[model samples]
Target: MSFDDVLQRGEDELLSTRPRHSLSWILASQFTASTVTAFSKLILTAFYNVELKGLNHLDNAFQYAKDNNRAILTIANHMSTCDDPMLFACLPWRYFFNYDDIRWGLAASNVCFTNKISSAFFSLGRILPCERFGRGPFQPSIDACIRLLSPDNSLNLQKFTLPPPILRNKPSWVHIFPEGFVCQLKSPHENSMRYFRWGTARLVLEPTIAPVVVPIFADGFEKIRPEEIDMKTDYLTPSNIGSTITVNIGKAIDDNVIKSFRDEWKNLCNKYPNKDNNDDLSDELKFGSEARDLRSRVCDYLREQVAQLRLQNGFKEEDPRFKDVNFWKRYTLSRGNSDPDIQFVGLNWAIKEYQRHVKLYNDKGEVIGEGKSERPSNL
Candidate 1:
């Protein structure tokens, strides 16, 4: 069936089964232990020494948001199924510190129905059904986010438009995985990321607002069955010597690079903004493309770096796994062994440029997931 037809059915099905539930109420009731979760989540992020590169991008982003405190919208690349916990774990508090609400996550409608209990309590997925016309009916979360964000249509490029909901409210940060679902393919040949939906791109454009488009790529997160969220035993252990994951935060996307960005907001702002979107892509037809050349550059850069690490310095000094030809984790996940010529490259492609840092989450004194631990979880 055509994409439009599928979308129509999806929308129709969702509207018919529209579940009227209050997020605020659900969160308050389901997460009665939130006081417990807050402490745990905070300590894990703060002391863990989890550093983000290109964080200055968000630093500057926060400044732009100073006007009305319109919340920042972060677009992240989705890799693992269990990426949400890590998402909360990955970000620094300052990112969400200023706003009354920091974490706003979106999930495909399917996830809501499929895992209602979990989505309601622990890793609840907010259900939003999209129409073929790019509209969802009476979604409170979306409406609240849009209202809180107070998006100003004065900043967008033509092709991308922000929905009206974004303009009404002010949010600190809204985390969105535009891929729409979790990545669940196999490994050694893993990493067939779905194409990012343009909805996010449109949001960036329309709000006449430019949010910190934090492009993140997460590794080490795979299919997480609801039955196996127990980090104390099965999930948390070191899977494979080579089983390392990487999450990279790429540069932001802006109208400074798109002529359409300037044209859209020329009349709105007193100052005529500069429009020379620095794109690496040589697309002859598509205009105002900032991430146009992102794909080729990321691929090329990863391939070369990985190749160098394998052939030259080699990972033998740091990781002995690289010493054995059969122990291919280093070559596969390392920045030195990627080869573009080989179509079987893995997901490490998105994070090849990032430095991987690991900090242990010992429930030694802390309360682990769902009362498993005693030390308030974060320890």
Candidate 2:
């Protein structure tokens, strides 16, 4: 299938085709992720001390979660594949910080659902797989997430009181990595943060659950696990096991900002709103430029927050490449080892090797399939 076909297939099939949730699988995955996190922390402590810079921000977030103030969306930078599990590991384990029913996230389909095993593992880990770099909107996945995080279904309306009763809806939180893909740590562009994809902006602006976005900046995971990490060469490799990670959790983006973005988006849509639900994608393409302007209003704001957090944490600002027309092309050319020729020459080999090591590709180099195809479940 062509890349466009793959993207269409994801929009059509990903959420619907997911396997039915198994309670046993969910519990096992949680236990395993927790264990792996514990091991990672143990290994990391020997190298560098773990420091959290913005405790007050986190404390306030915890309060929001406890009180069920609003749906929480934690947006963080994607520096390493280990980031998800590491976030859980670094924070104190509390009932409010539960991952099973309370927290969920979107995972890259290619990376997380390479096979039935991986699919089940990530699915149980509360990750909903979506096309990562594919062209089309990951519609089903996005809609599903919006539904999962809808305030009405996920939170207990009751106010917090002494000896808080077991919450009914579980008060959920969904984590998002706006950068879309993991950028190389040593890339020249590493001085500044990468531009965020507009999908997240769409999610936040579309209303289902207007989440309070909490921005987090993390550094040093790239140091601990190299950017070109492979299961065989680096997963078990201990070269930089002791590297320390610094996480700065900034204050939640103002609710008024969300409202403003919503207003801007609604105004844009009003100009050429979809009259029929049949061609959502076509309608978007027909008015692509306008759609982008609408998306940018939210995407830029979120990225600016992340960029500010990075600067506050001592990282220098690099050029904002997103403003350039050739940014992606430049980013591709930048990927490689120190030697430009060798980096280009060995790029395919390196990618294939990494895929093989991670079981994303079989021994014969065939892509692994996510279980059987099906339609997304109804909300």
Candidate 3:
């Protein structure tokens, strides 16, 4: 078998299990995270200057989660593929506001969980791998996310025995990028932070969960490594070293914000009685007008908060980069690094696996079962 086949088999095996972390694993991961943070501080301080601000906000948010037994849903802009690690490096783990370090996050399966090695690191970090797109009609990743955020029902004592109180009572801090994809900074809208997906807003309004939403404004990572630059080659190169990045945790969306959203949802529900059940409100719908309107309004409010934060962070709209689509390209070209070759080991491996799967299953243009009637093909 080819190396790609091996990676595919490993990826498949990892995704088969549900996402959960043992208490011992969580503690070990926290220790690793703390070590990474310390190393990042030391190296970045000596080589590339690092500045961390608005940590008090993170403290307050974590404190709130601890007090309320509620989960924390942090919505941040997706600036770079390494934002996850950057967040891990910058956030405090042990010293002050200690327990704030323990957190869980979602990572794209195709990109982040392609092979056993990467899977080990991400799983230890408490990351749940999600498929960006599934081959079949239904998306397993979306279903996993919904199940994760939805409330737990453990009414049956015999059927379900919850974990220990310490583990059970721990608040979940889920980090999400509402932008859906990494901002390429290729268009004006992308540069201005105008495009935001409705996933975060919908989760906030979920009746069963209704997690407190926190907006995070991140800056300067682009300076360290622009999207046009290759992640493996151009990022952190000699020329790009010593650049700075900032992550500012904003205040959580309080009760007033939730109340406003709830009021709007109620009004829309009253106007269109049957539309409350629909969740896909990305576009206007004739039948589900209430869900559509509520989604739009909630998304608008959230985006506005992010936009205000960008402005406050000194990202001027009149900047030439916003108007110039080839701004980063021009910068990269002028810097004399024209080699477009980039390599991401995990993503490349995952693509190879996906290709192999498609070739095997989709030879006849439509996917078909492979072996026998008695045992169905899992893929």
Candidate 4:
């Protein structure tokens, strides 16, 4: 077999036991997750004046998902690198005891899996290394999430048969930062969030059963680990220790809404049956224009859900321009040239270079042209 065949075989085997860590790994992961949870609680309680609202909403969603054997997908904004594992500290202690009940999160592979030691550590913590700017949402890690959410559903990207029935029985929980980047606005009270990535849409559309979707809005984490910190040496150190961290958990998205959205996606797939197939490629890539349109729609709706939570918490409505990717790309590039924060200089440059070559698409999904000369008017 060719090298490509070997890689394909490996991926198949990995997905066969999707999200199920080995005995040793599970034990290690449980220990790591528990320790982190305890540490997070201590730090937040001791150093920060934490205000967590809507715990009952989270409790209701967790219980409903557990009772019905449904997968849970918790979506939140990414304000700082520590937004996760730290944000989860708000959950009650009972959540820490059951390893299965804990969340499996996606961390940027470039940042979290830079070396073998960090890779192993993060993996044991139930964190999946995702290629945020590389292979992107279509990579195997995203597929692993899909399989975990809906093992019975066969994806277009599947290269082998489904996993064992036993493995498919238990539903898992997944938490994603739909914004895909740590976005610190001009002020803490600013309600703006970056555009929701299409990966989040895949988590919702591809699942056989719609995962219970819960939106969370967190503020003050930006101060805990601001982007201005020196990425080289200050990673372990927390800044603004006494900053107030407010966490708000919104009610789960209504089941009927998710069902209707899935149905709409299904209709689109049926309308463009052959658009997702590739004869030369072993695994199908769902890059059809119709699929992209559906994904965009889903992402917009999901962003709105999170935005609503922000508004409910007394923040003003976000600027209409915040939903545009180009707007943020321009903003980042401009800041990279002037910002004194050296830590994010490289990241901002990468965004700048990416935007330079990015194509501009029209409403019909045609690439009308590429590259814009003018900056966004609001910027």
Model 3, runs deviating above 4 Å:
1-24, 95-101, 133-161, 164-168, 186-191, 207-209, 231-239, 263-289, 318-379
lDDT-superior candidate, 2 or 4: 4
Over all chains combined, what TM-score does candidate 2 have?
A: 0.74
**Which candidate leads in lDDT?**
4
Give the best candidate by TM-score: 4
Per-residue lDDT of candidate 2, residues 1-379 (tens digit) = 0122222333245433543344555456567666766786676667666888887786687577557545677888877667777765667656223553345778777578778898877775667876542233435566555544454442222421222111224445778887766654444545345577777875686534467778998887766656454555457665575566888889988879888877766666565645654223335533478777767667778888887888887877756554342454454545443234322111221122223223233443355742332212210
Better of 1 and 2 by lDDT: 2
lDDT of 3 by residue, 62-95 (tens): 6776666556777777666667666656665443
**Where in model 1 is the C-alpha error above 4 Å?**
1-51, 95-101, 113-119, 122-148, 151-169, 184-189, 223-245, 258-379
Give all candidates' CA lDDT scores: 0.39, 0.59, 0.52, 0.69
Give the root-mean-square deviation of each candidate in angstroms. 14.8, 9.1, 10.8, 7.7
Error of 4 at 316 (Å): 1.9
Q: Higher-TM-score candidate among 2 and 4?
A: 4
lDDT of 1 by residue, 280-329 (tens): 11122122333323322322232222223222221222232222323333
Please give, for residues 1-379, the per-residue lDDT of candidate 4 as tens digits: 0112222333463433334435665677789899888998888888888889999988999889877777899999888878978898977888878776878888876568777788777876777766544344566676667656753432333554445322323577889998877777564324368889888988897665678999999988878887666666777777898888889999999999888878887676555444334221122226777677778888899998988888877788787767776766666667644433323312442352333334444544355655542422221
Candidate 1 vs 2: which has more TM-score: 2
